[model samples]
Target: MQPIFRVQSNLLYQRLEDALQQGLELRLVTQGDRFCGVPIALDEEFIEILYLHVSEDEDSPEEDPYARTVWVIRIAEILAVAYQQSWSRDKLAQLLPTDAATSEVEES
Candidate 1:
């Protein structure tokens, strides 16, 4: 997974909301070093996650290698969301186009 963006704790919900509205997939990593898949649902206290994993060996047709599952957790557990470096709003804002920068100023 590529490291793209890091959202501050205070901005986490707003960033997640924007991502959800844009139909973006986000991989959430916890402080415990666990990868808790894409967020499929969220609430004030918890978030529902969906993760996919594929087995390395293709030994038997009966043994399905692909697996998907959901995990739910409180917001306090999350540490970061994996994203492409270029897509990081906080990091890339200084490099934005003039018009976009203008819009940012307007928003502020």
Candidate 2:
């Protein structure tokens, strides 16, 4: 038998779309852990985000390289979603265009 999935509300979809449009950082909670990233795209079944990773080489612990990854996550696995209103916001601000960043600052 096929597993049943809960019907997600339109409000949730709208929020996700807004996040994708505005380059907002989001935190997603799944059954196992939490993930934080900027949304790239989404459909009924899944959402994609650019996940940033910083790794340090064991031999050179002082140097940490930054990596960006596209993470496609199943919509069904998302238990909850929230705006990352802390350091992530600051980090995303750095990634946005200067004009956009200035506009956001002016708006705020």
Candidate whose lDDT is highest: 2
- lDDT of candidate 1 over 8-34, digit per residue (tens): 455886666665565566777786766
Model 2 scores worst on lDDT over the 10 consecutive residues at: 1-10
Instruction: List where candidate 1 sits over 4 angstroms from the true fold.
Output: 1-9, 59-62, 85-108
Global lDDT of each candidate: 0.68, 0.79
Could you say which candidate leads in TM-score?
Answer: 2
Residue pairs of candidate 1 with colliding backbone atoms: 4-83, 4-84, 4-85
For model 2, how does the per-residue alpha-carbon lDDT over 58-82 read when each residue is reduced to its tens digit?
Answer: 6766444888878888877888888
Measured against the true structure, the TM-scores of the candidates, in listed sequence, are: 0.55, 0.58
Measured with C-alpha atoms, the lDDT of residue 57 in candidate 1 is 68
| Candidate 2 C-alpha RMSD relative to the actual structure | 8.3
